[model samples]
Each structure stands twice: as structure tokens, then as C-alpha cells.
Target chain A: MIIAEQKPIQEIKAMIASYQKILVVGCGTCVTVCMAGGEKEVGIIATSLRMALRLDGKKPEITEDCIQRQCEWEFVDALKDRISKVDAILSSACGVGVQALAERFPDKPVYPALNTTFMGMPEKHGLWIETCRGCGSCELGRFGGICPIARCSKGLLNGPCGGSQDGKCEVSKEMDCGWQLIYGRLKTLNQLDQVEEILPPKDWSTDRDKGQRRILREDVYYEQTV
Target chain B: MAEFEPKLIAFCCINCPSSSVTVCESMGMSIPTNVEVVRVPCTGRVDILHLLKAIESGADGVYVAGCSDGNCQFTDGNVKANRRIERVKKLLDEIGVGGQRVEMYRMSAAMGPRFAEVAREMTERVRGLGPSPLRR
Candidate 1:
């Protein structure tokens, strides 16, 4: 899911300082899973903004709205009329959602209230750790399931980088060496021979940097149309 | 006109003081001098941190008046607020202040008398509890 963190209150306040009528839009998908931009979070931000504005002696006409998936056009379209009513929009969604909202409502300025962190999963119930970089190309099969792209301080392929010590990365003693983890996992799976194959340099273009990629299931589409 | 006015109480959210601003004026209150009226869309929107900050800012008492349990406009917002208030109440106690210092009440905006009752009741309750420990 798209991981995000709420921007500091002071900074967020400054960004929307000029607008008295503000709309806080929350996303209920990735950002929600990461506990950054959910309905509950939206409410918290809205309340904080209102109090801050009240203290400033300016009556801010703040409103709150949350969409199921802000990245999707359909969900954002639902917010069209409401978005038009506000002076500016504060998106609690990840970067994608913020951009999507901006595109849909070209006239209104959309502000990102949350910092889009990375693609990650909940480490525990409330804690999340980065697991993917959306690098476009995935090589998980070659190196167990642990993603070196995100876990390693350097996005390395087939690396212990000589910086690994005591099963930890040299960049930080607290961090487990991604390569070490990959090595251990592969050994356990009896794929040690696979390590003999040197990993070619990563072609950055094929992955996320190549630009947006899409998948279309013609079978499913045909089934639905007929 | 007492020189030392009691702390102002704020009721925020639709689930809170369901009638919005009218309840204050009808209750013969004029923002309680110290009182700040913060309107929110739902009681669920009331962040637990906001409640803590209110107490931190030296509010003698803080009240979150939301829609009655069964009548919450946002369905479970009142319930969520109740749970959050309960947590904040515990936090208040942990900090050596009586958790009762903060409260949540359910009432529609039309209930002006009810609003006054809450105001008087909260004021008296705070008076009995004494000024906030944070007060100088």
C-alpha cells in the first residue's frame, strides 16, 4: 500500500493559510491501510485545523470528505460538487491521490497534507515498514522474498556490498543486511546454486522510472462486454 | 462579573451539540469569554490529541457534546468519541488530573436548556475539581 505520514501541523497550516474555506479529503485505500489518510485521520486533521484557525481569530469554514479510493476517477468524481465549494483542498491521500484530485479539479489548488512515504506493509498492527519501491522490475524470485530495492540502504542486486557485517548493514548497525537476509533465505530454500548466476546491472528504465505501466485483461473485458 | 472567570468549554462536531451554534446563545451564554466554540463535522473527528491539548492549554473543563448515541448523524461517530474520551479520561488521570476534568455529552442543537444545563453542570464540576493543575 502507499505509505504516508501527516505533515507537521505548523507546516500544513502555513500551506493553507490564505484559504478560509478548506476541504480535507481523505483516501480510504492505501493511505488508510498505512494509517495516514483514513476517515479517522481526516477528522483529526480537520479538527486540528479548525482549532488552529479559531485561535488565529479567523473563522475557517472547514469541511471533511473521504473517498473510497482517491486514485480512481470514479471515486474522485463523487467529490466534484463538494470540491467546488471549498477555497482549497487538503488531500490526506498519498501523492497519487493528491495529484489525481488536482487533475480532476484543475481550478482548485490541492494540497498534500500527508507525505507519501513508500510502498510498504504493516510490520505489526500499527507499524509499517517499506518493502517495495515500485522500481518497475521485480527480482524477488531471484533473491527470496525480501526486497533489496527497499530494504538495502543501496538498491543492490546480488549484493552484500562488502558493507555487511555481523548480518547487519554497515550503514547502520541496527539494520539487518538485506543481502544477508536474501542469502539466508535462499540457503534455506536449497537454491544456493542460483547465487552462482551474477545479477546483471539493473535497468532502471524498465521499472517505475520507465513511466506508468498498465495491465489489461482482454479475457475479462470480453467476458464482460458479451 | 467575577474577575476570575471559569475556563471556557468547547463543543465540537455534528455529533457534538447537534444543533451547532444556536445552543450557546439560547443557553444565555456568550462564548463564555474563555470558551472557544470549535465546530466539527462529527464527534469521530475529535482527535484524542485535541482533548489533551485543551487540558494542556489550561481549560478548567472541556466538554465534547455530541449527538445522542442512537441519533449520531454519522452513525458510530458518537460511539467512537465516547471511546476516545474514555481513553483521554484515563490519560488525564495518569497525569495526576482527575479524568472527570474532561467530559462528553449527547444533545441536539435545539436543546438550548440542555446546553445551559451542561454548561452549568460542567462549570460546577470543574469548580469542585479546582483549577487545572497546569494553570499558573
Candidate 2:
């Protein structure tokens, strides 16, 4: 899932300072699961903004609303009535959702209230760790289900680097060397011989090297002959 | 200008502070008139939104009173509430509202006097801070 964190209130306040009437939108999907932007968070942000503005002697009209998924047009369409009532929008969704809303309503000013951090899952309560870089590639089968691209400090493809010490990465003592983990997993599975064959360089073009990428599934695409 | 009597709100866990409130009342002790006690199943149920809404709705100060640390009826409820309180405090400070307005306290159901003491302490602290700036 996409994980994000709410931006500092000061920064959000500054962004909407010029607008007296504002709508705070929350996404009920990824951001909701991460506890950054959701229905509950929408109320919190709105109330905090109101209190802050009131303290500044500003009589701002702030409204709170949340949709099932901000990235979907149908879900975002539910907010049309509320969107029309406000001068600006403070989206507490990921960057994609914010952009979707902006594209849907080009006339209104849309501002992001969260910094989209990474594609990851919660390790524990209130703790999210990055797991995937979305490099447009999948090679987990070759590395004992661990992707070096995302976990390795240097994104090394083969065995552990010289910097790896006591199974810990050179980047930080707390960070486990990704290759070391791969080695350990492979050893447990009696597949340590797999590491002897050096792997080829990754295909960079499949990633950001080719600019924005998209998947076109002809099977899923529908067309009307009429 | 008239003396400011800060409106304070306390989110007390039903298992502990609520019992403490009853015990305090039985002992002929009463909470301040300006302070309102809201009972919840657990301190963990007290979302940040609730705290912000209370302040926005004219609460000069707000605090969560739950079971002492490990004694939470729901096990880590108080601990979770403590983290949320800290987050809310940082948010309040960032929004120009002093973080001191919000706080968290823990005590067992047997401590009736401690409950009253917290009320007095919070009321006195808020009184010194003055009415909530958001108050109309």
C-alpha cells in the first residue's frame, strides 16, 4: 500500500491562508490505513485549522469530507457538491489522489496535506517501513523473496558488499544487510549454490529511465463499435 | 474584564477514572464546574479528532485520564493514548495554540483523591492560560 504522513500544520496553514472558505478532503484507502489521511483525520485537520485561524482572528469556513478512494473518479465525484462550496481544497491523500482531484476540478485550487512517502506496509502500530521501490521489475524469486533494490543501501544485485559487517548494513548499524538476509534465507532452504552464479545488470529502461510508465491491458479495454 | 474560567474537558476511561469520579463524589468531593468529564470505553478510543473538536468547540484545555500505564483494562490502551496525546500536543503547538493546553494522566480506580487533584491542577493550569482563543 502507499504510505504517507501528514505535512506539518504550519505548512498546510500557509498554503490555505489566502482562502477563507476551504474544504479538507480525506482518502479512505491507502492513506486511511496509514492513519495519515482518513475520515477521522479530516475532522482533526479541519478542527485544528479552525482553531488556528480563529486564534489569528480569521473567520474561515472550513469543511471536512472523506471519500472511499480519492484516486478513483467515481469516489471523487461524490465530493462535487462540497467542492463547489469551498474556495480551495486541502487534500489529505497521496500525491496521485491530489492530482486526480486537481485534474477533475481545474478551476479550484488544490493543495496536498500529506507527503507521499513510499510503497510499504506498517511494520507495527504507527511504524511504516518501505518495502517496494516500484522499479517496474520483479526479481524477488532470485533473492529469497527480498528485493535488494528496495532494502539494500547500494541496491547491490549479488552477495553482500565489503561494507556489510555482522549482517548489518554500512548505512546504519540498525539496518540489516539485505544481501545477508538473502544469504541466510537461501542457506536455510539449502539453495546456497544459487548465489555462485553472478546475475546480469538490471534493465533500467523498464524503470524511471523511460519516463512515466503505464500498463495497457488489451483484454481489459472495452470499446463501443457503434 | 471578568475573570476567565477556562472550560476544560477530560476524556476518562470508563474502567478507571469513571470509577474514580464516583468515588470522589461519594467522598463529598466535586469537580470544578467548568470541567466536563467524558467517559469512554478506553483511553485508546479517544482519537486526536475528539481532542481537537473539544478545543474547537470551546474547551480551553483537554486531558485524557486512564489507568496507570500497564494497568489499562484493555492492556495497551493508555500507552496508545499517550502517543496520540503527544502527537496532538505537537500539532497544537505548530498551530500557534500552546501544547500545554492538552495533557494525559494515569491513575487506578482506587485513587479518588488523585482524580480530584488532577482536575484541580488542570483547572488551575487552564485558568492561568486564559479562555481558549477559539471561544466565541
TM-score of chain B of each: 0.84, 0.96
Clashes of each: 9, 0
What is model 1's C-alpha RMSD?
Answer: 10.9
Worst 10 residues of 1 chain A by lDDT: A217-226
Task: Give the lDDT of residue A42 in candidate 1.
Answer: 90
Clashing pairs in 1: A135-A208, A136-A207, A136-A208, B13-B40, B15-B66, B15-B67, B16-B65, B16-B66, B19-B109
Give me the runs in candidate 2 sitting further than 4 Å from their true place.
Answer: A222-226
How many clashes show up in model 2? Answer: 0
Off by over 4 Å in 1: A208-226, B1-136
- Candidate 2, B1-136: lDDT as tens digits: 7888888899999998889999999999988888899999999999988888887777899999999868987889999999999989998888877889999999989889899999999999988887776774
* Candidate 2, TM-score of its B chain: 0.96
Candidate 1: tens digits of C-alpha lDDT, residues A1-226 = 7789988766788899889899999999998888788997897677666655555666688899999999998899999899878999999999999999999899999999999988888878767878888776788888889888899898887677898899999999977888899899999999988777888888888675647877678766655421
Candidate 2 chain B: worst-modelled 10 consecutive residues by lDDT: B127-136
